[model samples]
Target: MKIDGSALIAARQKLRANFPGRGEIGSPSIGTQEWLAEQAHVSIRALQYLERGEGSLSNLKKVCTALGISQWQQLIINYGEDYVSCIANRFVDFRPSIYPPENPETFANSSLLMTLDPLTLLVAKGKFETILLQEVNATLTGLAEPITYTWLAEVSLTPNGQGWLGWVKEVEPMNLLANDVPMNVPIMFKQLCVPQVSWGAFVDAVENLTTSQLNIEVCLIFQNFTKKFKVYVSVDLLKILFNEGRNKYLSPLPYRAQLKAIV
Candidate 1:
């Protein structure tokens, strides 16, 4: 898939939103483009090239890494034939506000329909805060019946300490995303207590787990990355990930992140 200019601009703005300052959003402690170039181990113009979506894949990855973009896919526009061309009706909503709203829904994921799929969310909020993300396995809760999901991994990040959380279960796998690559990645992050597992575990774990419902909150960011997005996962939809065998699932998205805030 090719990185579009709009993705580049979106990534830049997302990165900027991660920096801290005073009042309003926060202060920008990351400093100038020169500093960003230094951080990403690229030249000034190379950083510029990337910000303009005109850089090598290596440069883009480097910039993405330095900026703490967990969902680097958000920086690129297309993923072959799987891109969602038309927005589906906004079918899902998170109650109790999983996170504070920011940026006035400028990006595609902001659209309720766009976010409904289990795609990577590049969540950043405060400067020197934490970046938390999740491959949201979204399902409309009230579509038919009430489904209880077994929650997995809930840990604290901030001192005040809200935790990022998810639920796991076994069922006939379904595609949360139409795109193959993002769908079947063995999506997991390193944590102290919980063992990492692939998304494909559903092929086994669905049978492995006797029931569907366990809940835990976990830290989503380590240092400064991004804020958080409020979301709710439904247990009624037991979906498997995309491209489990095609890609190692480690190359693109991040492995290390901690919770900045969550509820």
Candidate 2:
């Protein structure tokens, strides 16, 4: 994953110039190059190379931390625009609108897609995974019959050091209410090891959950890691169930995130 060098340099200069110094913070701030080098604990040459977008990922990470940049995604989100060619499509593939027109005659409305915040799973270092299970509880009151529904999550995992990788075991569609059955379909289950790149799996369990169809719980379990972590995204489909598909057009996209460990 690459970042815009010019953006990095601009951010660094702006921050360094505005940093508290002398009477402002009761201590004098050092020169830009020297201060950044000391804070990041790296050579001045290394910082210069990174400012030009010609440094290693390790050095970039260090400098970014020194600049109060908590996550790499921050750089991409703040500076990813106008430098799309330098970054991967999977890392920054986001749009404000993906809704179809009103007339169903032109659009089949077979599928809807969404992108969430980048996910990082910290399996080592004792960092716990952030679990978010959102249940779409809506009724299909006004729509055509035989409404078969399906879902899928496309994810990408990049490990940091020698961390062992883990994958999505299975997706269970449960009845959030009483003992009501969500849909006519059976249980949805699948298992596969996720590679470094993107991998997508569809939940072929329920066609239609009627009114009680809700709750899709997915658990990502990480075993162990020394200095490894994982980062990825969750791409979900938007199949609005109530109010004549008005909910899908309400928001840009639903957001969900996963975290990684740093042990």
Please, what are the lDDT tens digits per residue for candidate 1 over residues 187-245? 22221213323222222332244444322222222111222234433332322221221
How well does candidate 1 score on lDDT at residue 137?
A: 28
- Residue 140, candidate 2: C-alpha displacement in angstroms: 37
Across 110-225, the per-residue lDDT of candidate 2 in tens digits comes to 23222222322211111122211222111111223222222233222335212111222223432122122222211112222132111111112112334322222223221110
Model 1, residue 263: displacement in angstroms? 44
Find the candidate with the highest TM-score and give its number.
Answer: 1
lDDT score, candidate 1, position 236? 28
Predicted structure 2, TM vs. truth = 0.26
What RMSD value applies to candidate 1? 20.3
Q: Give me the runs in candidate 1 sitting further than 4 Å from their true place.
A: 1-31, 82-263
Q: Score each candidate by Cα lDDT.
A: 0.35, 0.34
